[model samples]
Target chain A: MHNPSQSGASLEISDLSKAYGSFKALDAVSLTARQGEFLSLLGPSGSGKTTTLNMIAGFTSPTSGEIRVDGREISTLPPYRRDIGIVFQHYALFPHLTAAQNIAFPLQRRGMPRRDVAVRVAEALEMVKLDGYGDRYPRQLSGGQQQRVAFARAVVFKPKLLLMDEPLGALDKKLREDLQGEIRRIHRSLGITFVFVTHDQEEALALSDRIAVFNHGRIEQIGTSRELYETPATEFVARFIGEANIFSGTLVRGDAGLALDTPVGLLPVETRLPAGRQASLVVRPERLEIGKAPHAGSDPHVPATVRDVVYLGSNRRIEIVFDDGRTGIIRGSGRGTDVGAGERIDIRWSIADGYVVPFSSSQTGDGHGS
Target chain B: MLNDTRLRWLILFVPVAVLGVFFWYGVADSLWKSFASPEIGLQNYAAFLQSPAEMAVLRRTFLVSIGVTAVCLAFGYPYAYLMTVTTARLRTLLMVVVLIPFWTSMMVRTYAWVALLQNNGPLDRVFKSLGIGGLALIGTPGAIMIGITQILMPFMIMSLYANMVRIDRRLLDAADSLGASPAVAFVKVFVPMTVPGVVAGCTLVFVLSLGFYLAPVLLGSPQHAMLSQLIVQQVSQLLDFGRAGAMAGVLLALALSVVALGAVLARPAIERGYGENT
Candidate 1:
């Protein structure tokens, strides 16, 4: 009978930093999650996303800055006093406890009456569609069921903020997709603010209302999934979030507001940066049109050889190697003019589709330059 | 030849025959001699059971075993927990410390205890300096308990540590995040998970203590003799093989019962602890 929306708390973390000797795991990271918002901290391994979540959960303390929950500072508090619920990647269900007992643990810790604890445990089990599985131990359950029990145990306490650290990372692809839907449904019904940490970009985009992309102990960008995918703020975000063909070059001011003067040609970009500054123009695979000859349009086109052509049911993914030996991908309709490998083709995209972002050292290493 | 079934059985036979001759045959002989020695009857068991002196020895043996198990558990749990929590280098150092006792001769260690507990020895002198004078400890149950506990402590820590290291420490963090205090989580979650180790360690120490001959005899007196001491007395002094066999049979039965009880109590916990963690 607990009202989750009423109990939801706004979590604001500002200038949080954790230093282990000389290495800073979290360096001045700041973000906020409004009440009932589903925010995801998305990053690769060692990107400080999990560190931020641990700081919020009070498992890891910050060396400096504040963590405020509903306007109350809780940075110095122990994890038990924080009243926060966390679901670890390993599911962390008490192997000794049954599913019901695992859900009842938090309530029992709070000294809830036995009758109330049992009822709440039953409700939590039912919430996760595991009502009849209450008596089974974690080992007796499947991985997906165990994760469901973990989710139930985390939220059964009606904690204002719930943090999940790669909770679905262990499950198979099919189970992960199924649980993603279930998680969305649960988040909607419960209305508790959730901060999920994951390295899977598609999982972040499909599940989060907003995502904070992290890299090298810092947040590269934070925005809606559409905004992050369409207008990524930095070269790293563009490469990390999704497939992008980046044209690295110096920016030049032409008849178009700003364009990237690359090795291939001058690619028109619909983004603003200081003229003559080095930058990269990011273009999505789906936005690019590929054909044997240049289609009549004002969009800038690049000549390339089709290296590989993958046929999906509804779309064809063509891997093209540019004249400069850089590879790019273009997703077009499955039906085409029979584009084959080793065939010459022209790939073009409109200026509005090309996003310009400032270049960084990380972009030059491996993924972005490709 | 190695893959042949008969050859595999042949390879397995040598050790089995050695154990049968050297170990099981002696055990069976003692068991039969308990009843058949000095004519086949129940007189040895009855006489030993009816004698208040013998009964006192039996009761004291059990009490000492239980005391040793309790003392080992009390100290070893924290030590084992510390071993699990410390850094790998420190844990290795602690492991070496525990294993150092195992490397030395038990007799040597018990003799060392005798020197320490003797009148005006290092321990006695320390006690006297601390104002606890006239503390004659060498021939007391306290001295024996200390000796046996030191010898048996390595078993307890090793068992507890082996079980504790496999425990996913994140479960404690999960408990803390669920609003359980550190102490509550340790008692309810951590301690319960370590029950298998507790059972294994306690059962081993108790069973070993029941048949202990060296520490009790060296550190204790005839007045406070344990069951093993009385059995040795019947054999060496009285030359009463019947009484000695009866006492040995009783000790073996008690040890077996303790082992069976430990297995029964610990099976469910061990199974639950080692469930299929995908």
Candidate 2:
């Protein structure tokens, strides 16, 4: 059944729309996934990430759309007939069956020989490193163990595609990180297409080869993590992906790129932008430097008061009160930074580290960034 | 601290005293009366055990009760599952329909069954209209079974529905995504999860059927006399309180044993269900 030459399957979704009465859960959503790629649907709560997943999994029918797997339309197929595996956020293990029986359920349904079923079940359990726990019922297992059993059951059938809906959302931070690595490793070993849904930006960025950031039933941006983080097309993407310090200002003229004239000073833009456009400059917290010697012949120097200083283990996060009264964060190695609260300091960043995002009136007012 | 302790003991003792005087004393008095009658040496119990007529009634009662409980479970489980999976409005309507039969008295419900099942009643009339013969449905064991099932089905459905509704829906979805069909998911995931409710409902229906009087009295013939009807006959007609007490004791013992067995059987399922859900 293994076909090395036909390893990848392309999934194409076109103009998918789903509505619960008047409320549009998913609106004209469309995307494509190359085989053997890990794609994440990243969004906040009620942002249609799970809806999109349900549609792809055949658990839900889109109001209007088409889904084609390897160029074969499967939009109307039932979930079981679709031959796709899914892992839920709650790790829904069968309570009556032991881990081995749960993993063997699909194989048994297909009427495989008893000996072959046993071997495959054992292999699946071993793949999840749960070899010794085959006889344990779901209730006897811990949360992480149950999640691993769920993963084993999903992958036991070697499905063409796998859908995971916030599968690690219930685990603790340490466990979540551990299982994230485990899931990535499993994906690599299996070389199966995986579409994951998560509201957690860090998890999505860490695991996804490409991510589709969703907001209010629409895709704000879809790109690789580096592309989305370094050059976000919209303010939502900029704020959702990482901590972005946004300064609302009008674009000003500069020799190399556009500059932002804000309450602090003229903030130089990292990426070139159209001049005289109303824009907001985005600077990642780690990119901004505090208490460093000024670069030679830099034009803009914004002096600000240190509102607060938080001691992170690796770096000191300093909150600066700009001359116009907005706050910005700057990260420095804790050893060299002696700037305390109420002290005046000069905060600066390299011109290439700050980029301009289009100013939107509906953006959140928290100036300390995303 | 001393006053608080005294008040707490006083509060606890009040209910304990009330229960002891009002409940335990009556049962103990009945047990003493059962054993101590007509020369007082387990004569009533020996007579009850030795009499084939009495033994037949006991056997028939157990059979009928088991039959009724089985029927209730067979029908109630799917109804409960549908209630859990349906939309909220439809579920509420279905629940109301299940409960609507309970608002009327059991005797009235039994009489309604009589009206529907009698030879010249609506059921027979419908059969006759279809060119079929009028069937014998009343004053038989079948009538008693139907009446009991109709009255007892709600208890099973409501109990099972409560448990089934509380099940995590994600569990069912998970089974589906793992390539199990709907039927497989229901049998593997849902049926096992609702085992506690099924056991509870079965126990309740069985124990209640064991002591049934009205439905059997009204719908069954003299040959189909249940334990409760026999006890009433011994006390009221034969004026044999000793035999009646012995019969009552048997019924109580059977009911208690069944309840204990049910608790023992249901504990693991309940623990596993709750454990997995949590």
Candidate 3:
């Protein structure tokens, strides 16, 4: 039990934005972190997540809005004065400095006593589990080793907010998983506020206490991983976070509940849209059940043909072409089940599993995998 | 491209033959003359060694060389750093400014400095307004220093810029985010990172300064004569080839020794930094 407020501070970003000429990179994005939460800003490339991180780190000045750490306005402050730590995408360890020296740099710069700097540096190295790697140069280490050194350097001085911009993006899968575990361990022990920016949705879901999904310079939704995955507010959030089979149609009032009349049949949804407006409904691939026609008490059912069956290890991805000439994908564990391409199958999802989203005709029926 | 061993040997033989004919041949003759002098056994070498006037000239040459190297480092390091950090269009403009002296003839640039540092010239007028007009700058060690540094600053700037651009700028960002102020970050992280560039650039400037004759001859007086000029005096005025050869040999040995010592000191750092940056 480390108390974060002793070393970490709360952060509030209110109506913050940045623009390049006529192009807006960030548009009035706001977020907050209570003292020791791991908040991830998740988005695709150029979706303003990295821009927001840069603004918070004071590397790029905002065109408007304010960033406050524990109510101290820091938008006008330079990066060095902000007392934050950032681990870059490529671990920018000073190649000239040995591992221990790299960790000691910040301590020395603060004019900490030489003996204490040495002690703290050793402690930081051990915190990253690199106990005897103090004498090696950066190039002499492997990528994973360098990444650990970077984490140690960033956290050595106990910064209030440790900002990481896709710090694990460059590593291979095995190394990334290993470092993610190490980062989680460090976060648990240090209790520092971590503002991580990444495009990897799974990584965000695995690490974040809260995820702010960004798109086109605006935050689509901000919530926990479960909240964002289970109930996405907008169509972009629904399609961006997980595997979703999205259908677009006219919103129609129905007997049982609200429904959308589309090529995939009228889908009874839990959310109601404005009358007669074009609406979209999202049913996650895992939510759809494939079998015979549903009983009367069961949810809405659709007649579909199996166009393709992709054998994923634990689950088989069955691509369904609906009777109305539209397509959908359903993922389920198909052990001992005989399912092949061109097989006629019946698909249905519970009304509660369907989330009705405000649909723009701009992005119509397409499968999105994040 | 030169994977063929015969072709590689043939290509190397040309430079080796040319070097043997013009360079190594002259150096070998000089070494022979330095030892097998007027008495054929250490007479002229002893005269050259025991002379205080000659030793004083050698000492002053080294001082000027070191002073010029220090001045170049001061100016070139920041300028090269700016080149790396600026935008592309601005970088091109800065590059043109740095290369102006390099492209212009060395004699032409030295003369330009002479005109400026002479009495009532552009620099002299400014100095005169500052009430330092009485200080003679035209034919002194200071003028020669200015001229040499100006001519050699480009070498330092180019060398450092080539290495500085390769420095991962994110390291500076990392340092700043680690709570070091911008100036402190520059000193602790950025300066040490560019050590290889500094070592290479300073060695180039120092060695070039040791053998520089034209700028010193044109900008400095007889009282400020460097070893190159002293050797020229020995041969042209004193008609003493053996003594001048010995002096030239000594100057060559000194320059090589400085380069060797600098490389020895900078080897580990260069090896470490270049491995990552490249």
Candidate 4:
């Protein structure tokens, strides 16, 4: 029940639920966006991210809920009256109009003078670095250029809020990265509330001031990128954000915090646990240390046999199988220390590098355990 | 190479040979016969071009075809838009209804219009019961127009529906989110996007209307003879082959020129409507 402050055009959605007959598209979803903040809704396909966006855009109504912007109830307002800007995945520019005309579409609707609309259209196109392209039809421009025109057309009228649904999904990888940075820059410059939807985790992490990670029609976690990445509240969040090696074990009392008795070895962890409870330990691959020795007992080391080694340019990923037949991945920067398949090595990680997560049947079925 | 060349020549020449013998021969023979006797050379064509009655019939035919094309485009656009937005099951059902008219013979549909428009028919009786008299709709140009419109509307709807279905729904949403109301979106985005469909439907309806015979002859009066009806009267009633030949040639030329002009005028709209780069 978070109510956004009314100082600016903040959007507050609460208890938003939508169902299509028997299938629930969004299940009691709720979130809020402060004015001028770039908030991204990040999720995989069928995770209800687009559904939540469509609800906010007023293209689709919530089966039951409240959507308020600037402290005014706009749940039932038609999309046109909502005065929101939206950039689609396919960049729906009018084929008959040039870039300038497309940008002037919304302004013309407001009955602005032709000269004023022209000035604003030029400004919008310049903002997107497409100033000289105003006279060219969308067909004459490249895909990336057309996408910029779509962005200009959406924001030319200076709407209160902007919605982008996978706006970079159709671009090449390098172009997508470039546009992601450009979008963040524009958001900062315009200081308008932007609600972006994407299934790519890296895009969300790179661009959003705050991200709402969705799963199974519900928000699994919503926090700053660092907070969500470092201290994920659930196993789904931990695995979705980055690669993680999870281990199933029982917790025992330790001097520092707790100890997990896994099949590979007894490992220390930096999380509180009931003395005799079952828990799962999750650690990032980059946090693991692989070497010839355990470095004078800095941390408990488990002997493992190298199974596979993959070169990833900046880093090398080594897949290893422990003596107890448990497999895990360790990522390290490229170095002279070469390890091949079937070679024995010792893997070590600090207790503070891992967190305790609740074990679920579905989590075990994913086969992501170390 | 020789075998392939022989196969290609066979494929090309069979149709050309049949067309030359069956179609061209008959048309040439008609032209020859039209000038064979009784003031030959250009007399029949001169008579057809000079007579005010013939001129009036040709003008009426053009007016009726243009009118029917306009009526079909006006009604078919909204019907096609509705079909595009409806549920799949409902859209299929409505499409079936639009196409069912085509499955029945055009003559049967025109006859149905005749039965409905007569003084003692269901429509006239309803109008009479509603206290609206002095209609006198039967055997009039208005009745002929109605019959032509009804018979030709399905072609317009089907052609427009095919093109409308290909439009991306996201464009409409983009328009709405940019502050265009639903009505504005339809007029600015949807209507412009379906211009090719409009052109195609209009051309089809107009060309078909130009050549219509049974409907105008059955539903129209003697004074309302269209171009085709006049051609039939010249050839059969008056036994004037040259005049009929001239009229037929003029009708063919007019229909083809209109089609060519429509295609030229519609080029930009079609390109704009369908170009994916936009």
Q: lDDT winner among the candidates?
A: 1
**True C-alpha contacts between chains kept, each model in order:** 0.85, 0.65, 0.82, 0.71
lDDT winner between 1 and 3, please give it: 1
DockQ of each: 0.78, 0.63, 0.62, 0.65
Query: What TM-score goes with each of the models?
Result: 0.95, 0.91, 0.90, 0.90
Q: What is candidate 4's TM-score against the reference?
A: 0.90
Whole-model lDDT, candidate 2?
0.83
What docking grade does candidate 4 earn? medium
Question: How much lDDT does candidate 3 score?
Answer: 0.85
> Model 3, range B51-150, lDDT digits (tens) per residue?
9988888998999999999999999988998999899999999999988768999989999988888877888788778987577598888999999999
lDDT of each structure?
0.89, 0.83, 0.85, 0.84
Model 4, A301-370: lDDT tens digits are: 6788899999888889989887788788889885523789988888877767888876644532332211
The order by descending TM-score is 1, 2, 4, 3
Query: Clashing pairs in model 1?
Result: none
- The worst-scoring run of ten residues by lDDT in candidate 1 chain B lies at B269-278
Q: How many clashes in each structure?
A: 0, 0, 0, 0
Encode model 1's per-residue lDDT on A1-370: one tens digit a residue.
4576686789998999989999988899999999999999998888899999988888888999899999999988999999888999999999889999999999999999999999999999999999899999998899999999999999998888999999999999999999999999989888889999998999999999999988878888999999999999998888877798988999888985677889998877766688899998889999987767876776878999999988886788889899999998888784453699999988887778888888876742433311
What's the CA error at residue B103 for candidate 2, in Å?
2.7
Model 3 lDDT at residue B222: 92
The stretch of ten residues in a row with the least summed lDDT in candidate 4 chain B is B269-278
